[model samples]
Target: MTLIVTSSGRPCAFSEVVEKLAARRGEKLCLGEVVEAFGDRAFGPVMFFFALINMMPWPPGGTTLTGAPLLLLSMELAWGRDELWVPRWTERASVRRSTFRKLIGRFQRGLKLTERLSRPRLHFLTGSFGQGLIGIACVFLSIVLVLPVWGGNLLPAVAVGFFSLGVMQRDGLAVIAGWLLTAATVAVLFLAWRIIVASVSHGFDWIGRIA
Candidate 1:
């Protein structure tokens, strides 16, 4: 489980972290190991990774597994915590290495392109106060993602992923983009919930008439 630490004592790039995870292609990849791998650079990368899993076309209940971490991380960020801490149950949660590798490969190219375009700008937005705001938004989005709303997880997941990337790379532009996407996600979820409520209400009215 030993990994090479960069001169800065953390993985220099998110892709390198993925590569390290990929290298253990047949073993169980636990969240604790990932937390250890990121060391001092835990929050952004881990949040990005968890949200990325939700963004993918994975099996049902994926969010159930991923959403908890997002919630925990968001709370820490909002609280201005410098270090991440997860419960033992969460840390012990894992996925098969081969599955993780396949998932990473699926989106690696697009992520690389994003990396190329990203740069540190708008420093104020990626700073502590800004991150606290983003984290508050993430807490709401994470709850939305965990719900069983049909086809509801994608937008929030993408928004959270972008936010994580923005923080990781200190790309203020990306953080702005993430905020825009989060707004859109919230709007869509609100509309969806309204529609569901209307439908349920109509159904109950019809049942009352029948009786």
Candidate 2:
């Protein structure tokens, strides 16, 4: 991989790459441009991009659209692909430059603290085996993210984000955080499902009694 430095001559961080992409001149930013900008060996940033888009205040099915890419990416990572390759159709997918800027700006602000806290320290967890494990977990998380369950997407999205950032920066702590959050997300989803089921059963009982 090539070393990319910022204007201050320091190695570029994930956030820097995001900001650079956001600042580009265009009415719309195609997914191809984004892929080309990061190139290969930027698995974390590219996956993070897909995950982060789910946070946008989009309409119903928004998470499904954004989360689909994460599933494909996680599958590739799980299979231990050396390079990232998105679908050809994704290259044609474009978002309004104004919307892109807003999302990127929000992302920068939201992740400032995370960026400060992250650094390359845990090499072992970011190694091939460890990343493979993370990729597997991300596959499940991405599935949950795309589900229509209430409040399901948010936590899974966050967990996937942590996993991506951790793998990118070689921060085992972030991966651990992802694990914990993933567990919590699952538990919450299960509880929500049970509650819905119970409520439906009660409604059925009430209807039967009235009849």
**Quick one: best TM-score, which candidate?**
1
Write model 1 residue lDDT over 61-172, tens digit each, in one string.
6677778788889888888899778888889888778878888888889877877888889999999999999899889889877776657788999999888988888888
Can you tell me which runs of candidate 2 are displaced by over 4 Å?
Answer: 1-11, 110-113
Q: List, residue by residue over 1-211, the lDDT tens digit for candidate 2.
A: 1224323344666677777878889898777877777766668888887777766666566677678878988999999998889889877766677887888887786677778778887788889999999999999998887776555577888888889888777888889999999889879878988998999999999999999
| Clashes by residue pair, model 2 | none
What's the lDDT for residue 180 in model 2? 97
RMSD of each: 3.1, 3.1
| Residue 79 miss distance in model 1 (angstroms) | 0.4
What C-alpha lDDT, on a 0 to 100 scale, does residue 100 get in candidate 2? 75
Off by over 4 Å in 1: 1-11
- Relative to the unseen true structure, what is the Cα RMSD of model 2? 3.1
Instruction: State the number of backbone clashes in model 1.
Output: 0
